[model samples]
Target: MKKVNFRNKDMAWDISALILYPPGFNEASQYPTIVSVHPFGSCKEQTSSATYGKALAEAGFVVIAYDASFQGESGGEPRYIEDPSQRVEDISRVIDYAVTLPYVDADRIAGIGICGGGGYIFSAALTEKRLKAVVGITPVNLGRLFREGFSQYNPVAALEAMAAQRTIEARGGEMQVNELLPATPQVATENGLTERDVFEATDYYKTPRGQQPGGATRMLFSHAQKTLSWDAFAYAETLMTQPVMAVVGQKIGAFGGYRDGHEIYGRSIASKDRQLVELEEWSHYDLYDKAQPVSAAMEQIVPFFNKHLS
Candidate 1:
């Protein structure tokens, strides 16, 4: 694995990334490349990102796991801002860097994103023709996640409150920041979230199990406006023509499920080659780290990239 830094021309931020090579990799020969995108408010070092990078690399592809601009080790001001548009642009920016490497096969570039990053990968693949193939693992379209609640429960009032906050921020009010997970297990238990998705997320992200110095738990509250309005599959009917695969867990909790993956596959009208794989008894967070579920997801992912990228 090698660390790399490059300029994100679109956002004017320096992106940090790690490139993992296949075992006994030979720089003299060109190899298919895959970009692994991290989850929301997460960094390149997170379990999903590292897992994809290592697994794909061992499968004989040059894999890159990158920190999105403005988060993790990347260079940007007002840190932890979650701009969907910029996140999509970050994938293309990383591709731009990948093409410059002599050992990389520019024509065979592909991408895989986890959680919210999965949504960004789909959004980027829509217009970024350079990405030959794309895979989404337990994807979440933040727009839908914010506008329609996780279980499609009532969330209109919450969205309206976000709009109101947007107005406040526009008036120079201090930017409100919010935590995506409880800072402590006790807090999660106190909030009656003992076995919920957020509870698991809190344990994974805030504890030693998946913690990383660069993996922040907070994000700018104003980002809710952009997330509520953005649709990850806005152009799937026509613009998203690339071969795609979406892998989702069958037993994902109340906060998320196979809805986004199903929606993405169903709406990919222009894609002649698209598939959805649901791992049995796997929760959304399980796909992030658990060995069995992650491996199950990779079984679909590796072949999808190999078939398309070849």
Candidate 2:
């Protein structure tokens, strides 16, 4: 296990990451590498990302997991400021750094993105041609989700409010906005949230289940406006040219991107190698190493990379 901190020229942030290869990794053994992008608010040490990276490392591939700009150990001003454009660039930069390592096989590089990272990697796949394969584990397509949320209110009003909020922040006012993720979950009701979305999210954040050092309980409010319209699905054609694997858990929540991406991707003749693996009785957070789903997903994930990487 080797930790490397590199500066991302595109986003102008000092990106922190770890590159884990098998114990005896050396110049003699050239191995495939997987660049993993974490969920929106998570860092490299978060359980799912760390476990997934280590799993790949143990299986003979070097795994690179890094914090996106403005999150985790990565550097950025006004912490938790979300930028879809910069995030995509950061993914590409990670790949750029990975390919330079002596132990890495540049041609066999792949990417795995979890949760919000699902969509981020999709965006990266479009322009980063060096990536031979991509995996989205319970991905959240920010574009569609944001569109759905924005539909409830007038888009004009929402944009106006965002602009006003930015104005305040620009004037050095304290950044005040709701960053939602409950530390403790309450019982679910007839409200829009299902048991899994509300309770499961709480369980991951509240308990020691998947906590990372210095992890935030609340996020930047302005980030909500930033993530709403960041749609990566429109670039399916570019992404589909490379092999893609999507994993979703049936029990947790229905991730629309996998279904939606499949719908768009299946219609193409060129997108032949794309595959979707639906894990039964699994929740979104369950993919984050919550026993039942993690083991099964890992079974599929390891083999998928092994088969494609070589």
Candidate 2 segments exceeding 4 Å error: 8-11, 150-156, 186-194, 223-226, 252-269
lDDT value, residue 30 of candidate 2: 81
- List TM-scores for all candidates, in order: 0.92, 0.89
- Lowest-lDDT window of 10 residues in candidate 1? 149-158
Model 1, residue 303: C-alpha shift (Å): 1.5
RMSD after Cα superposition, model 2? 2.8
Per-residue alpha-carbon lDDT of candidate 1 for residues 24-137, written as tens digits (9 for 90 to 100): 899999999998999987899996457778889999999999998788999887787888998998888899899989999999999899989889999999999999999998
Residue-level lDDT of model 2, residues 1-310, one tens digit each, is 7778997455566888887877678877688988888876677887534668888788888888887777778888778766788788888888878777777888899898887787788778777878888888888776665566433446557666777887898888878745456545543333445556556766776667777763554556655576666677665764567777788877645445445445434532355477778887776777877666777877888888887888
Q: How many backbone clashes does candidate 2 have?
A: 1
Top lDDT prediction, candidate number:
1
Summing lDDT over every window of 10 consecutive residues in candidate 2, give the lowest-scoring window: 183-192
Best by TM-score: 1
